[model samples]
Target: MHPSFTRRHLLSASSAGFGMLALQGLFGAQSPLVTRRTHFPSKAKRVIFLFMQGGPSQVDTFDFKPALTKQHGKPVAKDSPTVFYQSPWAFKPRGQSGMLVSDLLPNIARHADDLCVINSMHTDHNAHPQAILQMNTGSFAFTRPSVGAWCVYGLGTENQNLPGFITINPEFSGGGPLKHGNAFLPAACGGTPIGHGGGGSATAPEKPLKGIELPFMKNARLKTEEQRRQLDLVQTLNRQKLAADGSNEALEGLITSAELAFNMQREMPDVMDVTKENAATQEMYGIGDGKPTDQIGRACLMARRFCEAGVRFVQVNHSFWDDHSDIFKGHPQHALETDQPVGALLTDLKQRGLLEDTLVLWGGEFGRPPLLNKNNGRDHNNVGFTMWMAGGGVKPGIRYGSTDETGARAEQDKVHLHDLHATMLHLLGLNHEQLTYRYAGRDFRLTDVYGEVKHGLIA
Candidate 1:
């Protein structure tokens, strides 16, 4: 190789031009992960979003419809092929609040009083891909920053050593990386995915996140000091390039991300190691070898650790709840896989005093319809679904909205996807409308031009 020909030049000329572009911005005055001020005083300082990929049936889970039970297996109207199917699980009052919870999620039922169930969550799309995209990014037609990305962009993070946003066991399909992607937002704001995407089934009995490690985290050829010196040399070149180019947002973002990645090598190992927890703690999350709850248990426990370590946003994905053909078999399996870990997460957080200021959200992209198809399962329903929130600043032990008698539509106090996003931002002391980013000559926000904060959900 020629003495003048550098590795950077080789990378630039090769198919790895994109990788070189990411390295161009390797130095900045201040890290983007530095904590910043909020728009207002708020109790919630962080968020843990439990994404149930594919839609879960509201009627079978939290929303109990006695009318549907009474009129089960009946057609909607004269000559209608579709018939109303009642939930197989029985619903009974749980906790002091007497919130009706199904037998499918008996573990979560224990915390009914601490839950603020929203039975009227409706989204834009009925399809899985679009609905999932809309739920995560607030738009299905166009790509945009995810809710986690937006949170990091708005408030930065409390831990400069870690990435602001993290997603555990994220799905690759239904919008893929774009679900947790930064989009037009700064690259530093994108989520740092822990495990490989498109994991196994919920009941697969394998710990998917076990033994996961960040790629390119270690250098076999160089000592720590040697690597630092090499980084310093590259940073000098990056600074020179920035000086020549003046101001570039993309370049700046790359620089910030590169530095954060380097710092993460030191802190992430300890944070990701759930084994460090006591046996009792691990048992609480239902973590064990060959257990059905082990996969989601690891994800949820890691979410708490990430948040406790000051990560601005953490998402735990439990794919999938799309039970179209076998509702009795599929829904119960999914619930069994997640219910214990989810409930334990809330209990653990409260016990550790983290729940007071940590926001926890649970739901899916959309929900299954009340009416069953010929296959004896429900189809996708974007008209009305259910979601729940706990801790944070939400009013616990209350049901905010409701669907019709048949649980077909949101009859009152409907909370659209945009409104949910707005309320989440509001809880974190961010005004959704005010959190804007200028890209392609127009100002854009997570909520686009629509969203009203559901103050009723707030304490």
Candidate 2:
């Protein structure tokens, strides 16, 4: 028989594997979920992102365009027969700031003094999948780490027992898991999804979170102590295999996920149960068994609980704002479902003194166009939109940027998706340029190689 090659020879045959093992050994001793210091001191310790999946009409929601209304039914251009459509909802000044907000979101309008609205937001794509991908991952052409993943990677979690990032009721389409995925980052940094948002129309009734369970969480056969013992034995064997393999990113990820799952089984059930909250609190969020606001109310309330418990990022997804047709019927219904809960969430966070340090982001993939289709609905417009940020060091009650008179494109102080990511990182005390992960022979960041932090938005 031929002599077997030594371990050194095996390593020499795979230098990349040897290097990976060395890198893992240098950083793997501590749990990746443990809290880490930020690049600088920042007021925001957590984030609660309210994602209005699909495009929400900026002209109908926050961006008041009297020009579009005045020119209603008139040709969009000198020669084109296509005409502009006015927003059906009325716009009125709200709160101390006198910011104009559409009546469709009256509850949110009441908190205008607390909001910093950015009207000239644009992205690269008009399509749902690409636009949503760019909004979440910063790239439409390539797979990349999500904004939530980057936040968790940079700051980790204050609560070691829970996931660093959590996403509630994520949609199954329009980029799906990639919207919250942790590509090229540590597996622990990815958003832990709770319930699923069935990909349906905006008017579809949202399902309640009554018996949602973490996949494979409950063990019917084993007692708690027995389960622990079994886990320990399995982990020990996994470690042995890891040692023998020298380097296996997949195996390492599996080990970390398993440990987190075990820890989550001990604490997540209690955290997810919103019924424990008092009646007044529940009523404040508009939470009821079969109400329009019930789904989002529960989501927003759960977001607060998660943030209060020290999760680094929590995303609450409300879906089907893609009003391509019958927008008159769709937008109002969608608003009814989310408006009160979102307003309540902000109020609740403020009352608990959490909003000051917890950043709240609200918007969607893009905005609807000013021109109306034959179906009386607006088409997708990637040119201009509105998104709002409150608390967490942002200047309150301010309106920044603007679209053109027709609202066809961003006209002034336009903020691109990359700039948004940069600003978000900056608010979290992370230098966007410095927060990079070395992968595929290059350093990858949430904003890619492009981004300029908009300091004016910061308080």
Candidate 3:
């Protein structure tokens, strides 16, 4: 109806549009996760990030320092400012691999052979907000796209209906949304956080995702034909906008998101309903059970379901590891809540044969120091920490890197935060240097200008 419109133009446009319709139908049926090709053959098809909030003490958890234990309550030298602290829990070898694990986490120790512990991990910041931001976004100095956002941008999602990246019970404190935000990336690549566990716990009943239920339409028994007509009207306006500006990537992503949300109404409810699982299975995740284990278990169980459904990235958070006082009491409770569920998640994934292509990563933003404070607790230390990985084409039953005699800093095979990002991207078949998004007249990447994939970790 514009002044330039003509009968001949309309006919010609219609012909091309009809052909485009056929192509759209074919592509639309496929997952956006598979929309792009990997730079190389990928070892991992998906990623599950288990975020342990509040820095967990390395010496008290996985990093066993025999010298520190022997020199408990002693200083490095006469009049030394920092006093040494030892773990109350005993460390013993577990599994056939003889991986050292603390008695504090007996359940996780059971599967020691599957873990690839990295003890020499170092980050830039020591503060909670900065460290948490760096761990999630690869930067603390500026807002940047989160690792989950990067994964979805590079890999897309296997499930066309569900969101590509989901963060269950993401904590609200510290860096909060900045830890999961997409920054300059397309908004659709950002993580969808379900439930609020940000206050340091996931014990509350999970609030269903906004706009998930269409109660009004459901009660009215809305017909498919009627829904299609309504959607067509919306698409008509969107198409006009797209036609006006072909460079509108944001609008393009919005159109795709709207379509995905519509399709999700048909499938998500079923996938979220863990009640359909057998009683034995429910018990495994400790859903109906009491205390801290109950909520974290549900979160872990939900992660498995999402992974099976082809979600590219699923983040399950367990929090309040910041034990500045009474670590003896605080850390044990945190471990009790997380250990059973984490062990169960690993076992279930392996049994289902999903572990081979699904990478499971576990760690906190940083780690606690070996120096005990007046409150009988360790303070934050960014120089050296510990993290572990399982499955996803990594060699199992191995410990890579090491901390100093007192577990104060990385003594050998040091891996910086950027290196960690690079390795994870490599596992997913993305070249860190090449996987970039241009914004503000400059190219940006998850690892910025620095990163080297630790090929030694890969199988």
Best by lDDT: 2
Q: What is the C-alpha RMSD of each candidate to the true structure, in Å?
A: 7.2, 5.7, 6.3
lDDT of 1 by residue, 1-459 (tens): 211222234234333443434444322433456666777887799999999888889998888888887788888887887888888888999999999999999889999999999999998899988988999999999999999998888888999889999998775336799899999877888998877321244544333544655568887898778878887888767756655564456666766776787788888888888888899988988887667778788788888888889999999887778877878888988997889999999999999999989999999999988888877778899999999999999999999999999788898999999999999999998888878776776778899999999999999
Which candidate, 2 or 3, has the higher TM-score?
Answer: 2
Candidates in descending lDDT order: 2, 1, 3
Q: What's model 3's overall lDDT?
A: 0.79
lDDT of 3 by residue, 1-459 (tens): 211121233334444654434323422332234456788899999999999988889999899998887778887577864578888899999999999999998888988999989999999999998999999999998999999998887887877778889998785336889898888876667888777321123423344333233232242555767776787899767766655553455665677777766777777767766666788886776666344676777678888999998889999877778988889888988897789889989999999999999999999999998887778778899999999999998888888999999898988999999999999999999898888776776778999999899988999
Reference-based TM-score of each model: 0.91, 0.91, 0.88
| Model 1 regions lying over 4 Å from their true place | 1-27, 77-81, 196-212
Candidates in descending TM-score order: 2, 1, 3
Pairs of residues clashing in candidate 3: 33-156, 33-157, 171-198, 172-198
Off by over 4 Å in 3: 1-34, 75-82, 196-225
**Superposed Cα deviation of residue 142, candidate 2 (Å):** 0.8
lDDT of 3 at 444: 88
